[model samples]
Target: MNEPAQHMDVGAYALGVLDAAEAARFEEHLADCSRCAAELDSALGLTPLLADLKESAPDPGVLIARPRPALLDGLLARVVTVRRAQRTRRLCLAAAAGVLIVAGPLAGSSFTSQNAPSHSTVSAAKAMYEEGEKIGAVDPTTKVDASVSLQEKPWGTHVALKLANVRGPLTCDLVAVGRNGERQTVTTWAVPAAGYGLQGAGADKWSKEPLYTHGGAALNRNDIDRFEVRTLDGKLLDTIKV
Candidate 1:
């Protein structure tokens, strides 16, 4: 194969902004280029954290409403503080047009109802399942286990779900139900034959152990009365009362 000219595209390629032709060409080159491949690996390592930053951010409207008065003089200095604070916690990134929210070179963001990696996204969901306020249930009829985690934001809620004891191939959704009866889909995924969180599932089949999905809703946490785990065809599995 005639190799394309050796252009160092580790950064853009890592972030997946490369055009299809560029990505294809870079991928072919990557087959042999150890340095670029290694660099890509390191860059992809940030995907989880990046997804966390993007997924957990508060409402976008808040940012546009609060433009920085001293745009130039203080912006750069505030950036250092923001990064430092973000390293420690999710710093509510309102203003600066929510520059940090909309990713440009967004590496590894699957962005499906949303995702970054099959694993990394699930891992991030697991982290949210642990850290956020949560409620759960095991359905009597469906016998499916479901847990809903919620992190309240000014605009709405960030949602994560851990679903187990469910058999598939089945499609399922996490619906955030409001006190007024409004329903918003937080996230959805298809379950496989092996099912999730089945008894005796080995670490090797951990991916099938539980379905972890994350998404956001427009309803504030206080307004959400419950979460429903249901199928696309309207088969309800579990209802987690908040």
Candidate 2:
């Protein structure tokens, strides 16, 4: 990479904003380019201690009074106004909830016994399962063994799972439940020839082993209490609790 390009990339690396593909590409370059890597490391080390002079205030002045430009004053006023509006909205929502709680008994004497089940709720669940099935195909082995492994990294957590002995032909629809009781169904393409795959919450695609995480946005970092791998036939393969 050219010097300017290398210079621009270092900032992204320091902030941990570089994507997986970009990080891998830059690391490859760093391995071959010692001079660039040293410069990047030095810059990264200094970034945290650096101060923004513009944001710093001048020494205390008597009366703390100064003339500010009209545009700057207007901008500051607008920002404060927006903040107050947001606070008001939140207060309104809270007050409405309090009113509901206080008026609940007055609204209906038998409200407590008014709990009812709706078929629509069941239909919605059925639809979701069907959608999961369509997207997540089960592997054929029918018998499954599930295991989860977690590792902490600088940016977030990474997890790997082993789903063993899944029969062939249906390696597709396997879904694993994480410790949070949330289900992650596997799609056909996520499985490789290997017996393990990496899955996280909100993962758009499943891949074999070493699930990539960005501060748990892709998965629930807090809920990673265990791993449960299951077969397509809805049989329990195995589980490893955190």
Candidate 3:
């Protein structure tokens, strides 16, 4: 599918309106397409609000033609209301996730399981430590501690990351580079403020998470030669050789 059509289907897929085959194809595409994944994530995150709107919204078939001004005003009001609700929900979710991350094992399991990571979390982290090659930050200004383990899975690479003594509200984009030099974005996420800790703190003091990126079916473990972490604007931050 072309980019435009793929983008268009993201909403349908998020709303669960796509048929089984179509949804499968889109998900396959989503594994490699970070842009569509981001859009779909946004739509899925707003699912509750979407459901509320669907339940409360009047059917167009039941509504008689109304004055143009009134119709326009009502539509604008609805849009504004939805936007406000979305912002509020996003803030709450972010705060909750941050709190869970900081509060340690007592609340960590539930949040980690729901978001990402699983029973394999510890093994993955250990594998990355013992086998993965260490990747250094390319930029002198940024403080990033990262490694990549290509042996963990046949499908994709696993990344162990730590951001320390750095400012927050920053985005970390993970890109996988093929042996042929083709690049595919694996994931992009915001590093929370609390993720960074004091310079002398132990690894446990710093927030460390294992990130998995399946660079689609085309790119496999052997195909990937390196992984990179960068800002959204394509600024080079760190690189790990497989």
Candidate 4:
């Protein structure tokens, strides 16, 4: 991407919406551009507020109209081109307001409304870990833990993931990568503030539980290589080799 195009991605980066490749390129640009770096820092401070605001948001499934990535990105880019800080802040607020505008009639939907569940709960993840064929590892630095179970199917592979020791207000995805250098998104989920798979005092019931999530890929078991758990912004949390 050109310098200007790279500058536009600040909002997406802040929102953790950029794919792996895009974020890497942007980080390269960020190392040199003090202006972009400053904007990024300012924008990032608002991310948790965005996530917090969405906690009770109405189901996205019901929205007939949603702002396109292009629209949001373009609006944010416009902010960057503005010479004055005052205009930058104003444009930033307008872009944010545009987002909340689309989250309309905003409140009161259960987590189930998101259509995300393959197993019962943390127990299912544990059962898969303890009782069956599985592979996994713990990241030495992040302390994020993950295990995967794979089953061959006529179409491809069925994957089960049990994730632990991760805290959030973060959205993450399970990715399957092929030996041939192809990647598939197996599944995705949001982690609440209470987190999963941690043992601690003063923790809520949600805090102590692990996550059991399932997804599928077109790659057969023999054709697959590894599974990675990552935040939406492309930060690798853990990798389980098959």
| Clash pairs (backbone) in predicted model 1 | 63-95, 110-115, 111-115, 197-209
The lowest-lDDT stretch of 10 consecutive residues in candidate 4 is 102-111
Writing each residue's lDDT as its tens digit, candidate 1 over 1-242 gives 24434335655565455678978888889999886676566555545443433444375433332223343224333433555575555444454335433221121123432544454443456767778987889999889989888898888999988888888889888898999999999887877666777775353343345667789999998999899988999999999999
Error of 3 at 146 (Å): 1.2
lDDT of 3 by residue, 68-158 (tens): 4444344435544665698899999999988754443324433555666655543333434455545544345565555444444555555
Backbone collision count in every prediction?
4, 14, 0, 0
lDDT of 2 by residue, 1-242 (tens): 56466545654564455678877777777788776665565545433222321233264333322223453344334434655686699899999998755333222223323445343432222223322211122334443444334444465444433343433333333333556667654322123333334344533222322211111213454555444454455545455554
Q: Rank all candidate structures by their TM-score, best first, as comma-separated numbers.
A: 1, 4, 3, 2
Who wins the lDDT comparison?
4
Clashes of 2: 14
Provide the global lDDT of candidate 1 against the true structure. Answer: 0.68
Where does candidate 4 clash, by residue pair? none
Q: What TM-score does prediction 1 earn?
A: 0.49
Write down the TM-score of every candidate.
Answer: 0.49, 0.24, 0.40, 0.48
Tell me, by TM-score, which candidate is best: 1
Task: Provide the global lDDT of candidate 4 against the true structure.
Answer: 0.73
> In candidate 1, which residue ranges exceed 4 Å CA deviation?
1-122, 201-204
- What lDDT does the true structure give each of the candidates? 0.68, 0.43, 0.57, 0.73
- RMSD to native, candidate 1: 19.9
Local error of candidate 2 at residue 28 (angstroms): 54
